[model samples]
Target: MKKLLILLLLPLSLFASLNIAVTYPYIGALTKEIGGEHVDVEVLAKGNWDPHFVVPRPSLITKVRNADALIMNGAQLEIGWLPPLIRRAGNNKVTPNASSFLNLAQHIELINKPNSVDRSGGDIHPDGNPHFHLNPANVITLAEVIKDFLTKLDASNSEIYNTNLLSFKEKWEKKLLEWQTKMESKKGLKVIQFHDNLAYFNKAYGLNNLATIEPLPGIPPSSKHTIELIKLIKEQKPCCILHDVYHSTKTAEFIQEKTGIKIILMPHDISALDSIEDLTSLFDYLTGAMQ
Candidate 1:
């Protein structure tokens, strides 16, 4: 009896579940959906934290130190410090380059790939757009990639991952169809936004993308551009001028006053809004607001 008890305890200690770490809460939710009880999922960035300037706390290093895999959006979005964090964690099992690194952009159709990048002014991604997570369609595309990655990493639990994939796919597809129906009923739906962050949602919901408050991506709003943008918005008469949670509301307020278009606040990143702290809530609240 003593030998059997000791043997059982040894297995539990030696065969603990895999430690999986995701870069953001949204990704953590997805991992949990698939991983269920088989894997331990930890999110490095909270749902409300800025994904770019997140300082990896000492505890984060410890978490990553024990993880089996590390996942991130990774289209240079994390170029600032993730590489160093992975190194400091000193975990051979969770090294950014060697371990199971799931860079999500690999599966989606990338855009805004500049022929040449010279960031003389500010941050830029020459590799292509890294904001693939903004669109619901891209969500499906990336889901397939994630499922494959999980299966490859833990082949022993491939069936569980597949089961989660099937369930998630059905629910997401149903919601997509419902959202499309709601958007299709509206005619000539016009919108002006601070940034092109809504490109994916606009496409998914059939919302008209008239123009942006910001003249270009990465460029701040200038008085001259704002004047022109207000004029354009006045001419088009859009229903709202969408401003992301992180964007300066000064431009949005100016446009709203000059053009009388409604100011709509949105969360481009999952962490940016209260109701949209996770993927499902993000879509639900956004679609409801749009409708």
Candidate 2:
């Protein structure tokens, strides 16, 4: 009986899953999809919270400390909160220099890179816009990157990871066509945004971003700037204000009262809104927002 019990537990230990810590909900979703039963994901930030201002809680440090591998959005999106968690966690596996760590931003080409950096310009990402995941096409690229990373860490399950990635890419590519058709009519349409977080989305769909509600990146809206924006909206006659769920829509609402423009709430990631549950649904909500 003792020999039989030992044999039963041997297979379980041979196929133990990896614990992956991801910086945001979307990355967690992607890792889980590719990892399937081979891995467990721990998300650090809430999708509904401001990605730039996540609180570095003690719980997050513990998650990082226990993770077998770590993945982050990078491009300085988590610059304010992530580093501290990694430092306090004291997990060599989660550090940037470790082989168990992955930075998704390095794989994707970032847009809106500032020519120069300065504090006077409000918050600016030196490597261009950190919100590259907004583009649906980029999502596919990220899926591939995650697949490769997972395979490297667990080659024994490489076949399963490859199959999952292929299924994801096939489904995603079909949805891409559907989204393109849905957004084709809105191409070249002018719009306003509370912040330029949707830069990649706008570029992907050919939507023109006239201006941002905030005077500068990471800066709050001001009365003077609000007045100026109202004037621009009236003059430009943009379709609507694409507002992010995390930011206060007060400034956009005021502009609406002044100009009669519409405000559409755009969620940034999984759980950003109740309806956004996964990667597919996240893009579905985004592409269907205009309708």
Candidate 3:
């Protein structure tokens, strides 16, 4: 009877799932879409907040402690927030060099890398721009990487992960075509932004970003810089100012009043607003915002 019980339990052990942790809502969504029933995702940051300034609260430490694996956007995007949580989690599986820890930045090519690194540059990523996910094409690449990571951590569910990926790819590609069609006419249009957070998005759609409101990355706006921006906007005649949801629009508004330009609120992640609840909605709102 004892021997029979052990044999019966063996199959259940083989099919056990993993508990995964992700740094951002977008990563959490992709992991769920790829891992399907084989994984549970714990997202650490709120979607509406600034990605650069995620508060590493105590609760996040507990989430990391209990996770079987961790995936992050990397490229130093998490440098300001995630390290402390990982150190406090005391989970070896989520360590930087562990097989269970996956960094998505390594799998894709990063743009906007600086020739030199310094604090004077204002919160620059030494590796390149960390916001690569803003590009719809990069989202497909990230999904594939997540699928492989899940399979490696739980080989028994490899087939399930693969199947889920195929379905996701089919749906995502169709969405990409829709977005591409919508953005086709907006090419070469000039715009201003609070920060260069949408660097990848601008590149993908052939939109020319004339300048940013911030004097430098992570630096607050200065009166001198704002005055210069007013002059530039008057001379260049950009269509509008693409402002992010997190930062106060006071500066952008001032520019708008001076130049008679429009200010469009762009959400950077899922739930950045009530309407943007998923990856599709995030891009949909973005592509449609310019219009």
Off by over 4 Å in 1: 1-10, 13-15, 186-188, 269-271
Query: Could you say which candidate leads in lDDT?
Result: 2
- Candidate 3: misplaced stretches above 4 Å? 1-15
Clashes of 2: 0
Q: Compared with the true structure, what per-residue lDDT tens digits does model 2 show for residues 1-291?
A: 999999999999788999999999999998999999899999999999999999999999999999999999999999989999999999999999998999999999999888887866666566799999999999999999999999999998999999999998999999999999999999999999998889999999999999999887788998998999899999999999999999999889889999999999999999999999998899899989987
Tens-digit lDDT string for candidate 1 (1-291): 999999989978655766788887767777777777777898887655545557878988888887888888887777766777798988776665664878876677777677777777454455676767767767777777778888888887899899998898898889878766766765468888877767667766667888877666566888888888878887878889777776568878877777778988877656678667578778777777776
- lDDT tens digits, residues 1-291, model 3? 999999999888867768999999999999999997778899999899998888989999999999999999999889988999999999999999999999999998999887777866675567888999999999999999999998888887889899999999999999999999999999999999998889999999999999899976778999999999999999999999998899999999988889999999999999989999899999999999977
lDDT of each: 0.76, 0.93, 0.92
All candidates in order of lDDT, best leading:
2, 3, 1
Error at 53, model 3, angstroms: 1.1
Query: What are the models' TM-scores?
Result: 0.86, 0.96, 0.96
Alpha-carbon deviation at 88 in model 3, angstroms: 0.7
Q: Which ten-residue region of model 1 has the weakest summed lDDT?
A: 121-130
Between candidates 1 and 3, the one scoring higher on lDDT is 3
